[model samples]
Target: MTTKNLLVELFVEELPPKALKKLGDAFAGTLADQLKALGLAGADSVVTAYASPRRLAAHVTHVWLKAADKAVQQKLMPVTVGLDASGNATPALLKKLQALGADVSNPAAAVAALKRAPDGKAEALFYDSLVTGATLDTGLQKALEEAIAKLPIPKVMSYQLETDCELPGWSSVNFVRPAHGLVALHGSTVVPVKALGLTAGNSTQGHRFEAKVAKVVIKDADSYAATLQQDGAVIASFAERRAEIARQLAAAAAQVGNGVRPIEDDALLDEVTALVERPNVLVCEFEKQFLDVPQECLILTMKANQKYFPLLDATGKLTHQFLVVSNISPSDASAVIGGNERVVRPRLADAKFFFDQDRKKTLESRVEGLGKVVYHNKLGTQGERVERVRAIARAIAQQLGGEALAKAADTAARLAKTDLLTDMVGEFPELQGIMGGYYARHDGLGDEVANAIEDHYKPRFAGDDLPRNNVGLVVALADKLETLVGMFGIGNLPTGDKDPFALRRHALGVIRMLAEKDLPLDLNALLAGAVPAFGDKINDATPALAEFIYDRLAGSLREQGYSAQEVEAVLALQPQRLGDVTKRLAAVRAFAALPEAAALAAANKRISNILKKAGDVDAHVSDVLLKEQAEKDLYAALKSVVPQANAQFEAGDYTASLQTLAALRAPVDAFFDDVMVNAEELDLRLNRQGLLKSLHDAMNRVADLSRLAA
Candidate 1:
């Protein structure tokens, strides 16, 4: 078979920057997958995706011009229905052959040619045929259409192409954007394909202004990127363009002294990359007085409003100078730098004004404004939510510390949502908690209270940092717990991926604090404490909420490399203190590696089944009822092992506790093998059950040993 490298491109208006990467990957993946499905591409085919502001393209290696022929075997019908009494072709058989595109002139010969095979209870007639392969033109057309239809387009535009020499009248088309050209090439030969009301061609438009010519002639699949870069002066690959922008930003930042560098944000870099064809990083500066505003406010306004990269000094302080990525690189770049500086001055000025006006009124006075802000319809105003959070934080703090910590947490929670009323936070909701902390400090609140207010919303997402101090930890916990319990109580539980309230994140936040921080707090008690704050607004959802938290915990633990069985073994007990979960899981892993683990686990499972059948056996063993030596030996083993295991468990040595039970393997196996648990005598059966129950209780102090059963 002969093969060639293939290329396809769609030239259009600028694509949505955030969705361009996904679109490019989907287009290339789907096209190559379709080609491979049709046998036009081999298993070894390599696909490379290229996406720019104005185009999406793919290059595939080892693609054949046409698929190879394949032999197909199709089942026709039961032999009894196709043949007559004489084993000759009947009218039905002739009609079936005709439908299959078989020559029916010699009906008898055609019937004989059909293969007979047993299918199920009846023998069926099978038709064997060689299917001709698909040509490059037809295959590419289908692939292109499918890929276009499956693009992850955020929005679609409908337009009409003007009448041309090939088409007589205007044709309506809908696409991601107003596509102007489509290029499909199999090596040097152009594959005839059409999509979005455009026909495949060897020519495509270059950069709107900087191209050497109006149109770029792509010679072949291999030369596509080179030709575009040389003639069009555009970076065709998204990654290459982003890398070039980074290089320029670094170089431009280096030109400025004092080790200043561009603030690192990949998302901003990608969006800027999608907005330009050729990047030219220029150093631009604003007035130094604008630095009076919070660096966060200034940095965010610059990046969000003007798409500029704010430079930072070695001490992580925002610098007066910033870098701008311009699409045009003029010989005299002072005009571009001056224009950017001029444009950003007003944005920075607005931020500074907001900050100055906001500080005039302390956060203590703004608490009244939150009463007008609605937090939720079922849950009352932000004012009411603040009270609930305050109460929960006080209770948590008192439990974790004493009077001083509780006072600080209460103050922080009270002022936390007050910042929502500030002009700075009102303009940028992302700065809510942060601004609150700054204002608290300005209001003469102690550092402890100020830090708590700022860190109350810590760990907004996975892998985020938790609150730094005990006061902060208490308030953060209270904030998350209130959200989880309140939402769940009102029956607003998360279903599938539709958690509009982010209850899942809140739950994980609570769990991370409890497990990672090793807080000496009971999860159930914490949830129970949060319930009273909602009063009658929420029902008692403690049980269901606890289950949801445990489910999330199990998943998180599994992601951390614990197997499902290991996690189940520890979580099955529903330990109240989540801080011990990791210790329990560690013990389970260590116990699983013991030579006696398998036998002990199986014995525990058998004991559980026996006790369950016996029904409510007391954990009291009578020596008089022990008739067999095996039963006596097992009881003695439990007496010795139970105390040692219990001592280790009390000392918080879960690994040692579980390991102590390994001594019972021999006696446990002997008891199950030699003792008759279900004896004819009722007293004997009850006594045996009691002995097993005591053994079961002892072995599972650290984890549910039965869960370790294979």
Candidate 2:
């Protein structure tokens, strides 16, 4: 078998930084899925992807070399049999075929119309689109261009020196930076094809500094990357980038001190990696006086704007030290540090001014300032949101088991967004939550209320820390509740990857807080309580918000590695409480792993089938009605086991509940073996049906055993 390699590079104008970073990963993954779905062997296809501001590429080697050969199938109707009198091809192709010196080539079309389909139809509409050849180079080049076309670049433009066309001519075009060109080489040779009028080339351009356009002839995906790296630029395979970044951070941190390290944030690290080619580490310092400004603002400025990593001191507090990685290795590292210090100095000065001014007033005194800010146009002002939050927090606190926590939560919710009005938080928007907490504490609010301000925004993104204190949970619930209810009320729901409100995140955060922390409350009623707080602002909030939260839970759980259907099944059984629902999901997952669990599922299905056959089995199997020994045995077995299953279920020992239910499997099997309950006697059949229903009720207390895949 002669195998071949194919390289596909889309050298376009410099793509947006974010788009460039995302496109490389999505491009490779989507293409691999497409190729495999086209019946190509994915394992044999080695795909190596890389991207920079200007170009995106995937090098696929030994890529199954050819597409699988298959006969194309189509359906043709019966009445169109001949061409027109002019000898032109006809709608009915027969006359054209004869004119073209052909026999009755495809009898399948006629045969299919007359017969039932074995392969849908042995027919020809316009001769079936056949696989003449796989042509890996041709297919690969086309897929790459199509993939780029499909990518959702945030800001797109067609650089046509003068002409206005979305697909710019290569002669004079520009991307965000500039579109030089793309290269697709087929095993040490330029892949010869022109699908989108782009010809494959053996050339590639490296980074702008020391790297230049060079002829790179590679034999495989691995070699292509090594060739690129040798030329310049890191070929960003996900695993490769991750490992390299980790090594750089570790090495940099070790150089500073054993106790010092980069603060944790996965997303910032990813963006930082994409923004640089070779990472050269540097540790810089800020004046300790700036630390007096809220650490929230200080750290946000460092990480968010500068991509500077803050380092921890030995005492586990934000310190004056920071570590930053620059793209280029500068001769005067001191000058680089000085330039950064220059950039942040003014920002830190502004932060200190905001902090001083904010501290002059109590958090309560600043509460009125929220009225000037807008939360969402339809949802009302920030002041209105605060009112809603306060109302919701009070109810949630009550649901969460107390008056003290409720009062603190309500106070925190009312004052949480106060920092949005603060000049310091305005300058550093990322510091909103933490700043509010800081100011509240400075203003002499109790620790519970002050802490709740910061804690409510816990787990800002997925896997972020949740609030440990009950006071925080209450306020968090209120904040999330108000957004969800208000957004859902106004019908500005997320659709087709557009979630302007991040209602989904709020729901996930709410679920994580409620379930992960095992908060004592019903989520459904809490959502209800939030609606009234929103007052006439919400219409039909109950069911809609419930469904919205459910969707959020399903997505969040699926992202955490649980199957969506599994979450749905559990939620369908009980949507009253998120904490219990999550627990139930965990229970079902654990139950699924047991050896006897599959049998129990199969047995439950069997019971369902029997019950379905003999309807209305709600009553007792009076000995008079039990005409069969099998029916009597099932009744006796269920009576003994149902009690214990209920007990375990009440105690929430779902694993034990599943085990106890499985114990009935033997009796159920034996009963099925001996029973012929569907006899001529109607009463006996009804009696057997009732017995099966009893068993179902007992087991379903833990899960819908009927839905479990045996």
Candidate 3:
């Protein structure tokens, strides 16, 4: 009846950001699951956890003071699953033995697998037999360790006392950090920690160098965590840390008077949390002359280089002041401010030199240098990629605009990556296409070219924005296509989280841009169109690469909740545009929500059940042999809807097309209900079969209704 909280904090050396979140989730989930198997979980109770770069902790709440009594069964549940071709329990339980992959051909071999006790008094089969008893808590702990051992922590480590237990491969258990300790607590008492050689304890430490070891005794689980904080550790709740940082940031910015703001980087905030213990925001000022540099450069220089939050005016203009977050509180505030400014100056100087040097050379002159930067080991250079981009962009642009803009788009694609050779982009690699646009415009190139140059890498991440202009969409896709095709050629495709080339993101970006940009080009044709423009040799045919593109596209769409059948339904028609495919799938998804779609799905299933026995349903329907009135009615209903469905398809009103095809469902059910398809007369039987065939084709115009969910 009584409960207590449980706390576990793993104090380790700094963990990589790459694996910190995953390790935290594993610790939380494994701990909760372990307790649940022990019959210790409370109703609706959640396991809470967090990680700093240095630590990972899990707190199990409403945990029973003692694990509840659990009935454990050692026997695996067995049931009749299938049968041998000749029906019998035969020598074996036919169904059970078939499911076990036993040789059904030799019935006696299957019979031998059945449980025959050592005493020769086998009471029952394995399915019916049961073990008398088992312990729950011990089993739970074993299962927990097995599952946690598989959780991915990319930077693996071993912690045994070969003391520096860090090895390249499996000598001991690998973890994100040294996995210094694992604290397992069950209510107020220590859970067994022999697995990780740790014990739940009352003592905790703080800020390794700054603060001394602090001791506090915990009466129960609640006090266990509360006591850790009382001993000077923040305990690092991500949600709390985020809120605290936001609140402190808002208050600090307000103190700057006219205008100030925190930078919009969740990523940097995560890193900053790892860099500090008790985060304190300190406002500092740099020389206003730094503001004379372009505002974009100043912000990047401050935020990325120094990790200093940039201060912006009310109108979003850059100000000379910045906010620095420090871990320790010191009396000499200005001295710390001077230290950050000193670190930031060289980065600011680099940006200034890049700006001055790049302005002198027109975007046109930078093309020669692109050849020196190899695009891939086999795929020539960036200069060659631009040439291929020009050809591909020209063809794609035709779908976006008239000849003039298409020509302008091709011209823009030709020069987009020229800025990669520029001094500014060389120092700031993140600003590759970005600097191209800036330089192109300042050198008097038209706006379209500049837009295309910058927009080529839009939708860089899943939640990132897509390119706004048609010119950008064309080049962006051309770039991703080259990467996808070229990588597939060189055998560097992603496998086992080894996407060093970022091909998945590139594929997703292509899919998102095409669907959201409303471009009306055939993707299959586009893939075919671009593959020849690749490296001099063709390792894979255009068709094979097109199919490859579709696989990635399907994977990308499936992640958005489209089922494999739904993707196939849309993809089968070879949709002319991604927007068209998305629209068709959306209509199917929406119609799937209606009870009528379910009704239609059920009716289609009945039709499939009756006709799927035959070779193919694409057979011709015979009008001459209709016998039953229901048969005549159904045939007429299907023929009448064909034109209506085609009209809706032409107008791209898929909802209307589905509705039009659904008109045959009533007549279809009537025929199936009243008329026997395999009648005494062979002519009528064939006629009725033909009628169902027509129904299959008509409904498929909307989507294969047979594939939709009932």
Candidate 4:
């Protein structure tokens, strides 16, 4: 079979920067996958995706001009139905064979050639045939249509194209953007394919202004990127363009000297890469007075509004000069730099004005305005939510550090939501908690209270840092707890992935703080404390909420490499103090490694089943009723081992506690082997049950050993 590399490109208007990467990957992946499925491409074929601001393209290696013919076997109806008792073909069988493109004129011969096989309880007839492979022209057209249909377009645009008629009829086309050109080449030959109401060709338009020619004619499939870069003056590969932009940014920053570097943000880099075809990094500067405003404000305005990369000094402080990735590289470059600087000055000035106007009124004054701002229709105003958070925070603080911490937490919680009313935060909701801290400090509040106000929303996502101080910790916990409980109470629990309130994130934040911080607080007690703040506004959802949190913890632990059995065993106890969960899991893991672990785990499972049927057996063994010597031996062993294990457990040595019980394995085996748990005498049976119950209780202090039975 002859084969050649294939190249396909779709050129259109500028694509959404954030969605370009996904679109490119999906386009290339789906096209290659469809070709492979059709047998036109082998499994080992390589696919390369190229995307720029105005195009998505793919180059696939070893794509055959026609798929290899395949032998196919298809099952037909039962043999009895296909042929009559006398072996004459029935009309149904002839119709089926006709539908399958088999010869139907001689039905008896066709039926005679059919293979017989057992399909379930009945014998079925099978037809074997050779299927001709699809040609590249038809296959490529289908693959291109499917790939375009499957693109992860953020939005679609509809437009009309001029028809090839002298009368000037227009044909409507719906696509991510208005289709300008479509290029499809199999090696050097143009594959006749049409998409988005445009026919495939060997040529495509490149960089609007910098292209040496308006249209760069792709000579061959292998030369797509080279031709675009050399003749069209556009870097075709997204990754190559991103690397070029990074190299240019680094080189430009080095020219400024003193270890200055461009701010590192991969998302920003990707967006900039998608915005320009020929990236030319230029250093631009705004007035130093803009730096007097918070660096976060200036940096955000420059990056978000202008798509500029702010330079950073050796100490990670933002510099006045920033870098811009321009589409065209001019020899002088002064106009580009000056134009970008002029564009960003007003954006920075607006941020500064908002910050100045916000600090004029104290956070305390803003607190009153939150009453008018609706937080949730069911939860009432932000003022009401603040009061609830304050109550919860005060309770947590007092439990953690008494009156001084309580006062600080309460003050912070009261002012935490006040930033929502500030002009700066109102304009940029991402800076809500941050602006509150700044304004709190401006209001002459102490560091303890101001820091707590800001850090209340700390650890916003996975791996984020927790609060820096005890007051901040209390406030953060209280804020998260209030959201979890209130939402859960109103039957707004997260279903599937539709957690509009981010309840799962809130639960994870709670778990991370409880486990990572290892605070002396009990999770159940903390949840109980949070629930009362809602009063009659919520139901008693603490049980369900606790289960959800534990489920999240289990998933997190498993992701951290703990086995399902290990996680199940530890979480089975529903330990109120989540801080000790890791220690218990470690102990369970250690115990599972013991030589006697499998046997003990099995015996524990047996004991649990026996005790459950025995109905409320007391832990007191009543040695007077011990008839079998094995039962007496086991009771004696428990009396000796339980004390040491209890002592270790009391000392917070869970591993030692579990390890100490390994000695009981032999006695337990003997008791179970020789003794009949349900004896003829009630007293003896109860005593045996009590002995097993006592054994069960000691073995599972750290985790439910029965869960490790398998």
Candidate 5:
């Protein structure tokens, strides 16, 4: 029952910078989980993960040396079959006891030891035994193997390691990297474990160049990180290293005092953190002439290509100086700073050259080049896609605005894909729409068109901003719609998580624009209108695409804190104008909170069922046919309440309309209680059905009230 803290480390070649954090987290998490599953660790055990360029390690607290023994009861067989009427064990009972390693020398003694328990209608013999627990050595071996197997390795490398036996032969081993060392310790004792052809030890290599010693000697589970940092010249924890880098970057920027700061990109920071063991921030600079190119080009090149953090001024403009996270901390540091600056100059010059050469032809001239660029094998060239987008954009602009906006949107859409042909975009594909905006302005097109051309790809990801102007919004909607309709039309719908064309993102973009901007366009009409632009290339997929958009909207609404029931009630109506969905949902929520809401919702559900069963019944009733007092009262209530609700609905006050209709709950309950909708008389049944149908129609104008029924 002894417990001790445990430490495990795997030393290998540099891990993929992008996947290091995931690999580390998975390694430590799986190891701890497997230990707990084997009962070698408590539920409240603490696990800490450490990762660097060359190592993945974990430290777990309160791990047991051996799991506690547990009692186990196992069912043998039915008592009738295990024992004879003479109260003696049969051959089957003796065989079962033998297989369970029970005392079968004396049959009566074995039979007396068995407990009879009722299983269903029959009695069954049960065996009880004390199961031995797993020791730390065996449990940790299983845990270590499971952790390695479950790591989220981006790629596996195969290598050969010499056999430890007498035979001098090699064996092939596959892992994320060629692992060289492994250390597993329970407290201060080295656990004799083996993995990847390496035996567990207390020593591991640290920083490639700056380590004070050849190997870091981890003393104990509690002192592993401190010992590594002090002796190995490496920060073992990924988060601690990243924080240190940020702190140094901030301090270095303060020294270059112009209110300058490094560009904030978490992905770049994480990747950089994964690439180094010990981080030393240094400020380096390139020529100011390189700033002639768009700052985006410089920033992207610095972050994506060089893994550098480009500094920006207070106004968010790129500064000439950038910060580099070096692994080694040299005293002079001038060589590292100069070498980085020299290395980045050529990259900046190439970007400048592409930017300069791209401006000579103008975006209009490059439009013809897009014809030769294949967009999709089935969808033809980028030229064809541009034409479809232009048509859709013009149509959308006409609906949202008039001729002027239509003209602007058409121009923006036409030039939007021209950047795909530019040399700058060819080198850096992420700058496709961005380069188009710059070239649009250079081509003497007004800022409106240039802005639209750029903003047309707005909301490229979740939570991204929408277009800044009406023209941009129109073109963005058109572009996303064209992709969505064309893809869905061709049976390229997103299945599971395999959306190669990002159809889900496109659908959500369309929904966000429609709902967030409160555009006065119908969702169904937009999907339908976008279809003709594809002509015969795509089938009509309006219904399927609308469902996809609504599904995305429902998910988004739920994530925003709307309950599933509230969303279901409102979306059940399939409200065409998505802008009004929120309003409808608000009204449904308010209606659901009423004291009479439960009864009304239930009655509405009941009415729906009766009307469905009765088939087509008109919402017409004759006063003479209302022979019952409850029926007459319900008719009077409807006549009094229907007009007020209708007026409120027409005025766009959905909440008010639903509340006004709440007045019918009392009369509705009485009618359902006192009268049968399907009476024996034909006229009475039809008239009662009609009365219920009328009430159903009024109650569900804003949302399907029946869906709100408990």
Candidate 6:
């Protein structure tokens, strides 16, 4: 039962930086999980993952040398079938025992060893045996293979390796990259395992250029990371390397005072970390004249094309300097800095040129050019789409504001997509809306219009900010609604994860603007209003689109910490004004906390079922038909409570409204307890049904409380 730590590593060519973290995590997690499942690793075992530009490794502590033996009980056959009337062993039973590796030389003794147990309706014969555990070699091999098979490789490269035997031949191997070496050590002992057409060993190569030694020898599982770092001159752990790079970047930025710092982007940092084995952060700069270009353009070019981090001053404006993460460290770093500056000069020059050339043409002039650019085959060109958005924006602004706001929204929506025709946006599509804002300003348009054009695509992703101003809000809503209605109209709705048009995102954006801004707009009316802009190009998808938006709203509310019961109850009403949804949810929660919530909810559920079965029963109940004392009492309670609840509901005091309805719990309970809804007389049954129908209507005005019933 002795145990020791295990270490495994795979050295290969450079891996895709974008997928490096995912691959490393999957490799270590799957390998350790397999070992635990196979009983080769204990519950307290700790696993550490190591990844670099050229290697992926894992270290696991407390792994057993061999799994423990397990006791197994297997059912043979029914006693009636396996044994005969004479109480003697049958030929079939003897054959079955022999196949299970049981001694059959004395059939009677074998039969005596089998135990009889009651199974279902009859007795069955069961065989007990001890199954041997797997050794470390076999277990690790299986775990290694399973881990390799589960790697989330972006792409697999196929290469040929020379055969190990005395034959002059090659074998093809498919992996993330070409495998050069593998190390597997169990407490300093080399474990015999093979993978990717290579046998495991204790040696691996590191830092293709800066290694102090040609080969790094991992002495033991405990010293894997330290040994690799000292001998190979590489930081094996991806997290440690990323932290080192971050620390170096901070030091360099602080050295160049004036509150200068590198731009913050985790994805860029991860990619840079994956591109280097040993990180050496160095400061480099382009010409100061490049600052005349918009900082977004310059930053995008540096990060996207050169994989560089552009520095920004305290004002969040791009500076002339940037940071570069070098894989190799040298004493004379001046040469490296100069080389990087020289390499990035041409890139910044290109961005400056595009920005200068783009401002020459006005966004107004670019409007005519969008007519040739196709948006969707079914939907017309960008020019036509712009008109539709303008129409929708105008209508929304009129409802939100007057003709003044509508006029501004119409201009912003018309020119929003004109950025797609600009040279700067064409080269860097990420800067479409951003560049539009800049160009609109150059056209002498007010910040209101320019900002709206830029922020029309705001809240692009999750947690992104919504529109800044009212005009921007109108345009953003119009822009998203146009896409949603257009796509859902043409049957281009998103399926599962395939959101080709980003309909889900568009729908969410619309919901966020409506709910967050607390706009006094109706969801159904908004969707209906946008349909006329499409003319003959779309079908009436309002009903389906409403359901889709409500579904997104429900999921979003749940993620915001509202329980499923609260969300379902409020969203069940499909409130026309999404702005009131959160208010109603708060009310429902407060009402659920009331002492009578459960009883009222249960009674409400019962009343709903009765009304449904009593089909077409009016809510009008004649006091003369109230023959039962319980019915009279319930009707009197409704008369006292309904007026107050309805007044609170009209005044937007939903919590008070629901709480007022809680007063009917006792009377509702008595009505159901003392009276049968389906009485023998037709008139009596109809009157009882009418009373229940009235109760159901009043209770469900805020939410479907029946959903709260267990």
User: Per-residue CA lDDT of candidate 5, range 185-233, in tens?
Assistant: 9999999899999999999887888888997898888899998888998
lDDT of 4: 0.91
Q: What is the C-alpha lDDT of each candidate?
A: 0.91, 0.70, 0.70, 0.91, 0.92, 0.93
What is the lDDT, from 0 to 100, of the residue 156 in candidate 5?
Answer: 90
83: Cα error in model 2, Å: 13
State every prediction's TM-score relative to the real structure. 0.97, 0.77, 0.77, 0.98, 0.98, 0.97
Which residue pairs overlap in candidate 4's backbone? Answer: none
> What is the lDDT for 583 in model 3?
76
Query: What residue runs in model 6 are displaced by over 4 Å at the alpha carbon?
Result: 87-98
RMSD of each: 1.7, 6.2, 8.4, 1.4, 1.3, 1.5
Tens digits of per-residue lDDT for model 3 on 1-710?
Answer: 76666676666777775456667778778767776665666566688876665667777776664464543322222223222355334433664556654466776654554553323432344422222322324543554565457567775667653433456443455555564555555565666543454444544555554443544444455664455555555546665665677678888899888856876778777767666656678888777776656677778777777777887888888888878887766777778778877887787877877788889999888788888888777878888888888888887777777787678888788888888888877777888788888888898887877888888898788788787677888888888887777777666768887888888888788778877876677777777778788756446554655565567778878988889878876676556577777778877877777656777787777777878786554456777888778888987887788788988888989887876676666787788788888788867776777777777666776566667744
Of candidate 3, the 10-residue stretch with the lowest lDDT total is 73-82
| Model 3 stretches with alpha carbons more than 4 Å out | 1-10, 13-25, 28-202, 208-238, 292-296, 314-317, 488-492, 540-574, 589-632, 670-695
TM-score of 4: 0.98
Regions more than 4 Å wrong, model 5: none
Cα lDDT of model 2 by residue, 641-678, tens digit: 88987898788777677677677777777777888757
Give per-residue CA lDDT, model 6, range 237-317, as digits (tens): 999999999999999999988999999999999999999999999999888998999999999999999899899999998
TM-score of 5: 0.98
lDDT of candidate 5 vs native? 0.92
Q: Candidate 4: which stretches are off by over 4 Å?
A: 165-168
User: Which lDDT tens digits does candidate 4 get at residues 412-530?
Assistant: 99999998888888778888788888888889997888888888898888888888888889899999999999998888898887999999999998898888888888888888888
Candidate 2 is scored at a TM of: 0.77
